[model samples]
Target: MEADYQPVSRTDAECLWASVRERASDPHAGIFGPSSISWKVNRESALFLGAGRAALLQLAHPWVAAALDQHSNLRNDPLARFHNTFRVVFTMIFGTLEQALAASRYLYQIHTRIQGAIPETVATYPKDSRYEANEANALLWVYATLVESALVAYECVLPPLSPGEREAYYSESKTLAALFGIPSHVLPATWLNFEAYSRGTIESAGLGVNDLSREMAHRVLQSKGTWVPVPGWYRALTTAWLPERLQEEFGLAFCRRERDAAAGARLWLPRIYGRLPATVRFTGPYLEAMSRVSGRGVGALTRTSNRFWMGQPRMMFAERGLGDAVELPQPLQ
Candidate 1:
């Protein structure tokens, strides 16, 4: 653990309420309107758990696993990486279009430097076959994973969406994918297609979990160098949320006590979370965006950002791109 890393405290959150209260309902600031299912679902705090689930799904993809193994220092600096990723995600969902575009550009710049041949081939994909970050298939899988996990977490922690709302959420997610430079053709046209695509990928031999993916999943679940000490219940819930096929492939283990605890959390946590005050439940990106539209200084709101949230970092990491110093950890053999 980094001695210098400070966990976000309750005091930090106390300071944020004033800013949230003063936030404006800016109609033109964000891509997803307040009425959109994307905004309603993405605003919740439970997505922090969803992010872990999504990362595992992405890592399980052979191409994504190779890319991250070769390029990311996530194992060495999990908190920093997670913070950077979360900032990008929440910004796309809640930041103004300009901010979302900026975050997307930053991501694209990073991905541009991430091209390389797979270290090991699987099924049809041979080793030494090159993969680029902008590749449509890989990008689509990554985007789909996040969107799917967000919905999973949303339904778990909030009221279940109506059938029509579910479709709207999927449709709105395409806009999010577009912001990240994913081509329209790559995205599934509907919620049904997305579900089928995700299932095919998960069950496909071509995307089976590898050593690299398993190691990364272990690190996330174990909370190694994690910003906050992940609770046992949280770990249990996230593991339970993972696809059963993946659990077996990744060798995730849980005892009876843990399973029982997870079952309890699955039953009660969402209800409790849904009951939280709006100021407490909504994410910082949402609040900051509202501040911008409401004519309040976003700086004040940002001070309390990334602090006091279960999923947020105690200390924020600086956003980085291609030229930034990245200390890639030793690749999983």
Candidate 2:
């Protein structure tokens, strides 16, 4: 496998930002507009169904697991971590151009501070092998998991996208990858290529789950900070959906009862969930975008839902300051 672990350079990031600004015809619509498949797929509240799958997939990557274990407050405040994550991501996808740019800069700042060594020899990485949160390859894997898991969740409760739609969505997602500072040269050229990359990575040693990864996986699935405990059916489905190798590596139990529960959800969830009202079915960020376009402005209901998704009543961008001017590391020679 390619071993380039370089973080994004300041020059590259600036170029990407310029391209995004040039392409944004409607600044209020952010990167993807209302008609985008990204909006259509991500707008659904049902994407929450894939949250566990995405988390577990991320944990399976030793670099991500190590970075979180060493630098994140996930064990102490998973909900806050989760909320902060969604806040930045949703802002990039659904906020205005200024908000999206601010979110990207904020995220870039956070990533620059997160660098460490692997605690133990896991998979191909030796003990004390370095990891950086801003590394393009690791970022790509995390991005892939989110994109694939969202599709999995969306299809679980809604009509599956056609082949052309899936390709279009993947094409658009390259922009999201650019926002993360992943170099275009390193990204898969097409959706089919992306699927192959995901499958190949899953089978590679880089994704071996170590002790910390297993512990973190369980902690995330069992976390109950403020919110009610994760339901059994949800856990069952998460475990069932995971690649069999990773499931064994994580030691997640997928007994017949769990299997039955996951099966039942697959059988009935789509039929019932498809009938829900738009307000209940769609995400707050999408609703807020709609309100922005309609000139109605965000309302109390949207604000309430925003709190659920973003942990705040509205997306907050840092005011212009030194911190807002994210200081990237010098480019790798």
Candidate 3:
């Protein structure tokens, strides 16, 4: 590990969790509730449109790419990776307080076991430089990509957020970042600062797409071995949304044909997407959350959608050992 890098200690995680939990107006609604900009923006199924872009951006980070290549089964079971990623994230955003906290602890536990050295020198990180999943900087980068990409995808089909709404959304997202064990001190103070940080990081040597990253990107975009391969236009949009440097590094072609396809999507998607039914337009977790708020509990239709989103009828927190019985460390006074 680098001498300057600080992994998120148990103390840090607990303190952040307590701070966020204490501020929740509706514990049953989780950290961010129905009124939150996070829900208003993230509830839309259209955000999945930017999922490929987010995955590619994450792979551009050498540490992230190395971690996934070395420790994850992403290549063998790409759908599992997708389901797992959304499972944790949706749980954090839409699950009840206990569920969200359980998911946080589960994620922290998983991160504790993921530490390895990069295989080759990539930009600022030297070969053999160590990476821990709980490292603040790396976690922050991944958090930023999700936040930015969600907004980018949301705006594609819906109206863009006002400047104030963007700031509020970023503010709420810091609590989600806390779940990742990233310190508030390490995060950008505002949405503008966050944007600047994201742009700067992408342009800097901190983000180096290696051969492994390129392979991972291909795997994520191609969906090989799956009955449902990614659509050509969606792939084009993903490639076009990336930074030009990263597009080149990943060898994604944005030829005239791809450009036309992407353009056509930008023209047609919004019109068609707006007319989708609520069950189809909103994610399962979001619907489940609404059910909770309405006192209806999770319905059969919601459970079916949950299976599609998370590969299970429910989050299965207890089955996964992330239940109420799992104890959290106490925060310091």
| Number of colliding residue pairs in each model | 0, 0, 0
Q: Tens digit of lDDT per residue, candidate 2, span 167-231?
A: 99999988888777778888999999999999999998878888888988888888744464888
Give the clashing residue pairs of candidate 3, or none. Answer: none
Residue 89's lDDT within candidate 3 is: 84
* lDDT per residue as tens, model 3, 2-62: 3358789989999988987887888877889899999999899988898889888988888
The TM-score obtained by model 1 is: 0.80
lDDT of 1 at 312: 43
For model 1, the stretches where C-alpha displacement exceeds 4 angstroms are 1-27, 299-302, 307-333
Model 1 C-alpha lDDT versus the unseen true structure: 0.67
lDDT of 3: 0.83
Worst 10 residues of 1 by lDDT: 1-10
Could you arrange the candidates by lDDT from highest to lowest? 3, 2, 1
- Pull out the clashing pairs in model 1: none
